[model samples]
Target: MMRWLSFLQLCLSLLLILPLPLEAFEPLTMGAIGLGAVGFGTYFKEYTYCKFTECCDDRSIPANIEALRSSLNRYLFGQHIVAQHIIPALSAHFQSRSTSRKPLVISFHGQPGTGKNFVADQIAKALYLKGSESSFVSKYLGQADFPQAGMVDAYKARISREVRNKLHECPRSLFIFDEVDKMPSGVFDTLTSLVDYNAFADGTDNTKAVFIFLSNTAGTHIADHLGNLMKGGKLREDTRLSDYESLLKRAAYNLDGGMKKTTMIESHVIDHYIPFLPLEKSHVLSCLQEEFWRWDRNPDSQKNKKLIDDIIDTSISYDRTHGLFAISGCKTLEKKVAVAVNYS
Candidate 1:
């Protein structure tokens, strides 16, 4: 009798401790999944549904417009990719890969309304045209979704495997993750693992995908902070402008003062001013935690002091209009399809 009870307990423990199998996070609600992509709730308002590129024919897009700018011309308005920051990444990705090596991993983050989506879309187009590609369909999983292993690692693994399969079928392709900041830390850590290596093994290749995280965590404040460190923040904008006008003379006079030196897009106008600084990850997460906790306290979003958990569980965000762009079901992957890249 004692042996039988011990055996039963051992089996039960093993069952409970087993690594989660993929497909458990498959999308059922919140929108399309498994080949069916869904619409992005318009940040400002509802617009016409975005038809998947599979539906688009070769004749629809111009052949000369093989690059990012032309590809995004139809969909983007004022929202555009910062070509200065992104073009080099693409060139590097394209130029590299002589043999087996780690892939490039780029993390883009900024404050809300800093045009995270626009940059992501440009990067998507760039990667998509390089050959063939796959994307993880986003779902709006809430805060409660964050703690579960079923929701995080396995779900992300499923997508990675899908991308890997596509790569074997089509060696040239890219994978992109939009609004990745919202996913739980478990998934983030797993994705980061692959990203750090920039490569995956052959067995897991079935769903391995190129990883890019588009985020709003990076902010403009870092530039100012760096600027202040170089020259006291006491100098007002107008004074700084005057100093720029006299830059050459200031350099000769020993007044270069360690102020930052930056280049402008057009020398003829010189209307644009640029600040230099990489948006550190720590600042972004700090702001994110604050927002996460703030949303946690809101009465409308809280599941309660007792019932479910995960700070992202109760977070709320509104677009240009007051309508709620709920983050309830944001993890989904569209089915993979075979297509040829004819950027011509």
Candidate 2:
């Protein structure tokens, strides 16, 4: 009897040490698991929808051409020509919508510190009303989006998909590609199809979307054209789009990586190549005034006046002889003013 009991105990210990199949464990019922998954998925979907569509509730986007112009002028200083050209084109495009019309594609070319990016932002802000952060607007930086030559193709594919996805979310989405001068050559070529007429299977059209490409490709040529006009005894205001548009286009086409050789330009999908002339001292001063007002500094105060004067006098300019423009345009003007105000 004792031997039999010892044998029974050893068998029990062996059984406990052996592994069991995974299926031996109890599991949740299919119905219960499915219901929990559905609940979580539904909640996630609604949460994402609310986050993206929140900007839509504002409805503060400029409704008319005059409103757009006012917003642009107030926010972006010394872009009078850009406003004059873009506003009319925008008004016409907004008024007319048809299957035959392609999406509006505008390229802004200028030096750094010029209001190229600012103007682009104001345009999208006035139209989308939610600013650049909206779901309706997709902004890309060339360096940030495409870091390597090997990644250009992948970047192109992703960009096309993002544009389509944004359009699906909001058909009239805005795409801003900043620093096109640094973008890969083939990247923008991919946008040609979308920029033209895009008819999807779901009966959705994306031709009304806007594409803005900002580059510094034609900056020097634009400045040269203006300098030539000045040398010929012509006033800067007298210079028109006709004078520099062709030159600017040619200069861009000559560039190696920008939109010049791309199909977007070859096929003429770009509607405008608006030039942003270098800012003069007066323009910089105007920018300074705008910055000061933005800070709520007392404009009439003698201390503030002296502060503004000292800041302007000390700030570096590219053309010291003429002092026509700051080296960084209004890019550093605001910071300079802030520092002066804080110290004084």
Question: lDDT of each model, Cα atoms only?
Answer: 0.36, 0.74
Can you give the TM-score per candidate against the true fold? Answer: 0.38, 0.79
**Per-residue accuracy of model 1 over 120-232 as CA lDDT, tens digit each:** 65555454432223333222222333435456557667655655565565444445455443444445433434433334456333122334444332232323333454455
lDDT, model 2: 0.74
Worst 10 residues of 2 by lDDT: 54-63
Misplaced by over 4 Å in model 1 are: 1-66, 69-81, 127-150, 196-209, 218-344
Local distance difference test, candidate 1: 0.36
Every model: Cα RMSD to truth: 23.8, 14.0
lDDT of 2 by residue, 1-344 (tens): 67447555655754763366645544664455456558655544454454555433224334356767887767777666787799988887777744446788888888788899888877776786567766778889988887676787888889888887877766677889988888777777787888875567865567777889899888766766676677689877777777878877887777855575788878888889899887777777778778888898875678877877776778756654344546578888777887877776
